[model samples]
Target: MSTERDRDPAGRARNARPRDALGRPLPYGAVGEERAPEGVVRPPDRALAEAQELLDAGRPFHAHEVLEDAWKSAPESERQLWRGLAQLAVGLTHAARGNSRGAATLLERGAGNIAPYAAEPPHGIGVAALRTWARGLASAAAAGRALDLRPPRLRA
Candidate 1:
């Protein structure tokens, strides 16, 4: 087998390794869950809906990838909101993977990132609600308590 890294059209190396639902890499040639495509830009509405679907399917890792794409491709004014959403999704992934401390930190950080937008949220993103959810989950994670792991609503 060629030991070459997979390359996208632009020649950036992409990990061709298969990943589990939580985004953990599996052994070579192992069949794994389908991954979200990298670097595809989506409008806020479409991105939120797609991420929500992945979250509901218990694929926070995939959700994070979608949100990360949004964050990377969004205009400067919208970067924080997308970043926060991505962080929350990754927080969920950490929690699912049993990294409680990491999960807690990320959840809290995500909440803080989105807090500024609470007063005038854009694209109908539920900033206040998401902040609440992130905080609650953060506390549970910090306490090493079990997480109920409900997906957050992306929009009001």
Candidate 2:
């Protein structure tokens, strides 16, 4: 089975389905599909800034895309940081879409992945705070409460 990474950013395969700005595949007859290009990993500062902007703008799904690029391009030592951030963004996206179970699962998993970075995150990202925030979100979702929590800032 082809994974999401196997698909083109434009979702243009022989059986291309449309996608949203977040790169989410739309249903077969869905309209208004956007062609959001996949993100490229830039310098750490720039990538974090861009991803934070997207998160603050209520676009966690887009943030996930940005972070995914970072995860793909980061050094081995920092891969977990970027991947965790991406997962956190995806968790938020699930929450916003009213998938509480998925939100909880991803949030907890993201927090676990981010735990090691809590002491000294790259670019001064508040990894500890982010993990705490993720935990809170997970708890809320587990309790069946849909929250509209603000995204955490990347800087300390």
Candidate 3:
């Protein structure tokens, strides 16, 4: 039997199922962390603060969702930055989930994506430091070493 997915008010397919702290979807009607509404156009400052708060709370997956929204709605010039941040969050999620391979790949990729901004980072983002942090974690994870997944400061 085919199961129908949840839909938003506009009929767009949305996952209304509750999610765990790591963003894993639980069964319908299961109590889970409250998810933020999607597709809203949050200003950069708001997005950053929200994402940072989530990250600090050990909810990297939730942070990724916020960053993904920013990336999708960002201007061309800033799109990659948001994308990188989202990737970093995903990397953290993988780390917490004990997927070292996934964590390594995403951490490296995300660091590379954000490295370009090192020369002249915008929004006061700590791109250089963040890239260094991710690279170090990625290297350790790749070497079969378990590393602590601490939340990096998003701003300089």
Candidate 4:
């Protein structure tokens, strides 16, 4: 039984292995493929608003998808900002999934990536505050405590 991963981009069978939700590879018969979500990148303002909405809805995975689209389509200079936001969303997703170690690592990495943009982040995202929040979350996760903190808003 050939799976999607076993097939190349053109759909030809290969040695590719399928993966599960947590990204662990599955047996040959198991089904799953890593595909980007649909939709073009919206303008920065609209994208931030939409991503924030998803995050607030406790759908950090979806938020990460949205932010990833923005990251892929952003100008070279702004890529880091979008990437950082996406990472943060993924951190939230990991936290929601009860993966404390993964959550803490992603949160800290996201915080570091976003720090340089703190003083003047696009869309007024309060990067500094968000970084502090991420740090707190990381610390809590490292201590084996899960926090249910409110999602940060993207201001302006």
Q: Which structure among the candidates has the greatest lDDT?
A: 1
Off by over 4 Å in 2: 1-24, 27-36
Q: After superposition, how far is residue 13 of candidate 1 from its true place, in Å?
A: 2.9
Provide the clashing-pair count of each candidate structure.
0, 0, 0, 0
- The models' CA-based lDDT, in order, is 0.93, 0.82, 0.91, 0.78
TM-score each candidate: 0.94, 0.81, 0.94, 0.77
TM-score of 3: 0.94
Instruction: Tell me model 1's lDDT, rounded to 2 decimals.
Output: 0.93
Pick the winner on lDDT between candidates 2 and 4.
Answer: 2
Across 10-95, the per-residue lDDT of candidate 2 in tens digits comes to 77654356666444677766773443246575899988988888888777887887888989999999999889998999999888
**Which regions of candidate 1 fall more than 4 Å away from where they truly are?**
1-4, 9-11
lDDT of 1 by residue, 58-129 (tens): 999999999999999999998998999999999999999999999999999999999999999999999999
Sequence-dependent TM-score of model 1: 0.94
State the local distance difference test value for candidate 3. 0.91
- Model 4 C-alpha lDDT per residue in residues 1-156, reported as the tens digit of each score: 644445557777655555444334578766865533544769998889888877787677767878889989999988888888889888877887788998999999988988889878877777888898888998998899858757766553
RMSD of each: 1.4, 4.4, 1.8, 4.5
